[model samples]
Target: MPTKQEILDLHFMDARYKLIDLAAFLDRVDRHSGEGDFRFDALKAALPLLLSEQQGRAKAVLDALSDPSIEPIEKATTQGASGAPRPAGVPL
Candidate 1:
């Protein structure tokens, strides 16, 4: 099993790859499509929001890992009264 830091590192690297892939994909689409294409416009508009969300998630994970008071992620899950598993720090 990977340690917490290792897991967080993998998450960060994966996020970076995803952002790069999105940019490359968009570039390819832009090159193939003509101006005023709805798909290009839509993708261009959404990229920033997607980047922001990924950044936010990365920051949150980093913060959780860095803060000593925060519980370890491995211990941050439990079965509720309904016998359903749920994550800690997240409310259903």
Candidate 2:
């Protein structure tokens, strides 16, 4: 389960995705036409939401990491459990 902070972070990330999408759209509009009023209006409307998401995003991330449900994975070793040396030229 995601903690309170984790949930917040996830939401922020999702909002960031929206911001990126809008920005890209605006860029395209600009490249194609100087009078791209619609794109600008859309971006302006999205600004507040994006800002709010970014503001609380960091705290949300910390909360997520604190959750016990999350697990840490370790990379496997080339050698066996006994720590025996591997043959030369073996790829990791």
TM-score of model number 1: 0.39
Model 1 clashing residue pairs (backbone): none
Per-residue error at 88 for model 2, in Å?
79
Best by TM-score: 1
lDDT of 1 by residue, 33-84 (tens): 4564433444454444544645475444433333233343554344533222
True-structure lDDT of candidate 2: 0.51
Deviating ranges (above 4 Å) for candidate 1: 1-7, 51-92
Against the true structure, what is each candidate's TM-score?
0.39, 0.35
lDDT of each: 0.52, 0.51
